[model samples]
Target: DAGVTQSPTHLIKTRGQQVTLRCSPKSGHDTVSWYQQALGQGPQFIFQYYEEEERQRGNFPDRFSGHQFPNYSSELNVNALLLGDSALYLCASSFGTAVQYFGPGTRLTVT
Candidate 1:
């Protein structure tokens, strides 16, 4: 019955550094999706994972990647971070095509 959860509610990083964000899907969910929300902008889908494999990806560069575990938890990794990478990284969970439930997200500040 637990809802989706994310770690390190806030994070700070420098340009060129990498960061990894974590997420736990809601109970009974088998899919996880990652999103990035810039200041004053709506969430943009980064990628989605189901069955422990990436099911879909967005228009992001190769620096963005993700992994989903058997337990339905997931991790998002961003390499060669840039100033533009600073944003709220959101994790959403869904059971099939149903509505997605989002976590509060990890605030990433790239300087």
Candidate 2:
């Protein structure tokens, strides 16, 4: 019955570094979605995964990628990170197309 969870509540990295964020889906949930939220801005869809396949993607470059495991857990990977990438990364889980519940989010800061 646990809700979605994300790791490394806060992170700081220099430009060009690579980062990996993790998430665990809520109980009985099989879909995971990722989002990026900048300061004073709403979250922007990054992508979504269902049945371990990337079902849809947002307007991000290839540098942004993700994977959902058999257990429904997921990870977000960003390569050659830029200062502009600094933002709060959120993980949301849902059952099929049902309502999604989000995690606390991981705050990433690129310097």
Candidate 3:
């Protein structure tokens, strides 16, 4: 049984550019949550989607958006990227409020 997975393990972008990160949840999971982790800091919740709807969101700005597909996969989009946006984006999947399983994360560098 494969766990959650993310794509483009590493990415480089420039300020003012836009980027989209993809994630696939583990089998049997229906909820996906996205987080941003800065160097030497704990992960900060970005948002979460369930049933194709945004169930919750964190303190992130509107530039951060997400979508959850019927198949339980999700995507995170960040627009007008800033150097501060450079961090490890993580995807965690869970089953109806259960424990979440996280992916290796996507490292984004905004220069």
Candidate 4:
């Protein structure tokens, strides 16, 4: 019955560094999606994981990756980070195409 939760409410890293953010989905959920939101901009879908497989992806490059566990938890990993990568990383959980519950989001700052 828990809601979506994301770890490391905030993070700071220099360009070229790598970062990993974690997320735990709400109970009875089987899908997890990741997104990036820049200041003054709407979120851009990164990808979605279900049944431990990536089902869909956005226009982002290969540097953005994610994984979903059997228990429905997920992790997002970004490599070769760029300053432009700084933004809010949000995780959303839902069952099928039903309405999703989003996490508070992890603010990532790239220097």
Query: Could you give the candidate ranking by TM-score, starting with the highest?
Result: 3, 2, 1, 4
**Across residues 1-111, which tens digit of lDDT does each residue of candidate 4 receive?**
679999999999999999999999998899999999999999999999989999999999999999999998999999999999999999999997688889999999999
Model 3, CA-based lDDT: 0.97
lDDT of each: 0.95, 0.97, 0.97, 0.95
The residue pairs found clashing in candidate 3 are none
| Residue 40, candidate 1: alpha-carbon lDDT | 100
lDDT of 2 by residue, 3-110 (tens): 889998999999999999999999999999999999999999999999999999999999999999999999999999999999999999999989999999999999
Off by over 4 Å in 4: none
In candidate 1, which residue pairs clash? Answer: none
* Reference-based lDDT, residue 10, model 3: 100
Best by TM-score: 3
Model 3 lDDT at residue 47: 94
**Clashes within 3 Å, all models in order:** 0, 0, 0, 0
User: Candidates' TM-scores?
Assistant: 0.98, 0.98, 0.99, 0.97
What digit string (tens of lDDT, one per residue) describes model 3 on residues 1-111? 999999989999999999999999999999999999999999999999999999999999999999999899999999999999999999999998899999999999999
